[model samples]
Target chain A: MRMSKIVRFSADVLFGAILIFGFYIILHGHLTPGGGFQGGAVVATGAALVIVAYSYEEVLHMIKKAGLMLQESAGLVMFAGVALIALGLGTTFFFNYLANSGLLFGMSVPFGPNPGELNTGGVLPLMNIAVGIEVWGGLAIVILYMLSGISKAEEA
Target chain B: MIETIIHVLVIAGLVVSAILVFHFRDLLAAALASALFSFLISLEFYILQAPDVAISQAAIGAGLTTAIFILAIRSTKRYEEDIP
Candidate 1:
């Protein structure tokens, strides 16, 4: 069931802002308060707004379930690979292997708020990104699947 | 005093919304009421100075959970059967 025009318009208007805010939270997880799960849930809420406003067929065109499934799988694989790489490097699992070592995503952050370095927090930020991707894909796919399932049930 | 008043109001709203969640015969409305309950609980978490938890609760509890409930309700009956 499609909503009123006003609802659809507002949803479209809010979607970009919500997506940006969610990514901001995800990237700044180490420096800021919100992390992967929080940011991902926020993004998923934005997708929910779109899903609620449009019909199932319209939503399918907007969000591909197969793509979401692939995204979810990729995110999980990347997260696990990132974590396991620390072990392969002869460090414990999920070690701060990149912190202050001048490797990729490695920079020293001082103790304070708003340190102003995006290239800090070592592998933590990468982990946050991986979790964010996994969560965003997982939650959005669940909503899309539920919508598709309900429409099928209605048809049968 | 102002903070205390805000806290009291949020807690009261939480109670009211929880009761409304149980009282509504319409499942969609109940899900909405639960969302309101989640929002109030999130507010309470903020009052307690846990902003991160508050954000998670507000997003997952108030937002996504409500969407999931609404979707489930779409598949089944909207209204509950009255007890004899």
Candidate 2:
């Protein structure tokens, strides 16, 4: 069932904020406490809020299952692709080849206890983002699928 | 002193919420109690300086799980029936 108008409005407002914050956590994983899984869970929670606030049909219109599945598969492929690239570079899989190599996200860290640089951590940020995307898609899809199942059962 | 007091209070609240979850016959109220327990646990994690874990717990456990449970309740019975 659909919620009250006020609840829907609040959910939309909160969803925007949570989405931004979750991305911030993912992007800053190398410098912060939160990484891919945590940030992805946060984003999925925001999506869940929107899902819960709206009816099943409304939610399906807002978020397509096919799109979410594509995102999840793409994220997994991207994560593995990064690891494979390391092997192509003649290093071990999941190697941090870009660090201090003057490439994207390649800045080296200082000795100790200093403020973190956003550009550091080699392929760590990339991996974080990939995992974040995967998790967000997977979790939101779980909730969405469950709702769909419930609706189907109701119709029968 | 205050930190210790806060810790004690949080722990007490956790116990109360956990018990309330088991005590409630209304599944919805029990779900809310469980959510409260998750929230308190997340708060404890934050106090322990594990913000990442806290955020995940708060979002997934307290927020998402509660929403899912509520949805399930909507599709089924809101109150538990006696087995016997």
Candidate 3:
């Protein structure tokens, strides 16, 4: 459907709000109920809004399918690579070795309110971020591919 | 509890929306409603403490997926024929 000015403006505003909100959820994931996946999905919703309010062609121009595919693949590779790194470090898969110490950026950040809480850890945060990026990119790409295919069919 | 009530309501909403999606004659409305249904389901997943699944659902199920479905339907001759 073609977007009118009012609809486009509304969608743009909503998309921006969701994008910011998603980042908030991702950054404070440890201290909140939200996390990487939730935040990433929220961001994807923002992209979806752009597509819906504008057009698939516009969205595709902004975020090409090839670039989105690369992003998604990179995110998956990062997650798998991290797991492999943990294995090489003599830990089980998905172990958070980096999170074991409280040092981030050479400064000691307290793990949490409690000294050794499970909630406070090494690789969990990083994993969450990776998962978020992966989900967002992967889903957006899937949507883009579907829309593009439909458009192609229409032309044919 | 309030959480329990919310969960029930969300599930009910999902079921109702799903039925509407299948039964509705208007393709766009049905798709939009289905998207809302998926969004509620995602919210339910969040309440259940599965952010990962919720994220995927919200992104894939509610977001791009629905738009793609609608666009596909639009490209078909169905919407055009119904406009007159």
Candidate 4:
């Protein structure tokens, strides 16, 4: 894949910028417009840009296939585990266990006079993080598989 | 009022990008445009107060998916040919 100098530099810069921006989104997801999954995908896009500019072989070497699969599965299991923990605590699935307990970092922190306030305790933020990881990892795996398959086909 | 205007602009950008994705003869360009569409949709999700969905869509739909499509198409050598 021969790319012009301008194209190569542009793609590299765009890819790097998106990756950084995605992390920013993930970290501040609870307080901002971006979250884990969105940011993670942005990170993956940066990886993809490298693949497009260079070669799939090089990209694969950088991001191993096995590691991606493990990360994806781990994310799914972690999410399910959290749901099960909620059930075990005598609540329905995905109940805000921490919120109901009035606990923050194991200390009794009360909600500010109102139950549904934005600052009130809840597991929604945690769920958001879990889902973000799951989506990012799963999508990365899917893309990696597709790219690897294409590369194999080319080799044959 | 400002929020509404921003929302409208984002939606307009999305629509324009979608149109470009379909109309462009270049597959790579179309894929890139589609990524832009995904980003806009993510922003829409943010507006709708569903950051989780927005994040998922942005990551999976725009980032990784676009790269996969581009690489797969590149390997196939069909991107160079015009679509009928």
How much TM-score does chain B earn in each model?
0.93, 0.95, 0.84, 0.86
DockQ of each: 0.75, 0.81, 0.50, 0.59
Candidate that beats the other on DockQ, 2 or 4, i.e. the better one: 2
Tens-place lDDT digits, model 4, residues B1-84: 998998999989988998999887778888889989998998999898897787678767876677777776778654556449
A best-first ranking of the candidates according to their lDDT comes to 2, 1, 3, 4
Model 3 chain A weakest 10-residue run by lDDT: A103-112
* Model 3 lDDT tens row, A1-156: 456999889987798788888887776676566787778777887877777666667776788888878888888888898789989999898876776465641223454564333345466666777877887787777667766777677678
Local distance difference test values of all predictions, in order: 0.88, 0.93, 0.75, 0.71
Q: Cα deviation of A150 in candidate 3 (Å)? A: 2.0
Which of candidates 3 and 4 reaches a greater TM-score?
A: 3
Which regions of candidate 4 are displaced past 4 Å? A1-20, A34-36, A100-122, B1-19, B36-58, B78-84
lDDT of 3: 0.75
Show where candidate 1 strays beyond 4 Å.
Answer: A112-116, B77-81
lDDT of 4 by residue, A69-91 (tens): 77777777887887788999898
Which pairs clash in the backbone of model 3?
A: A99-A122
- How many residue pairs collide in each prediction? 0, 0, 1, 3
- State the TM-score of candidate 3 restricted to chain B: 0.84
Q: Provide the lDDT at A18 for model 2.
A: 94
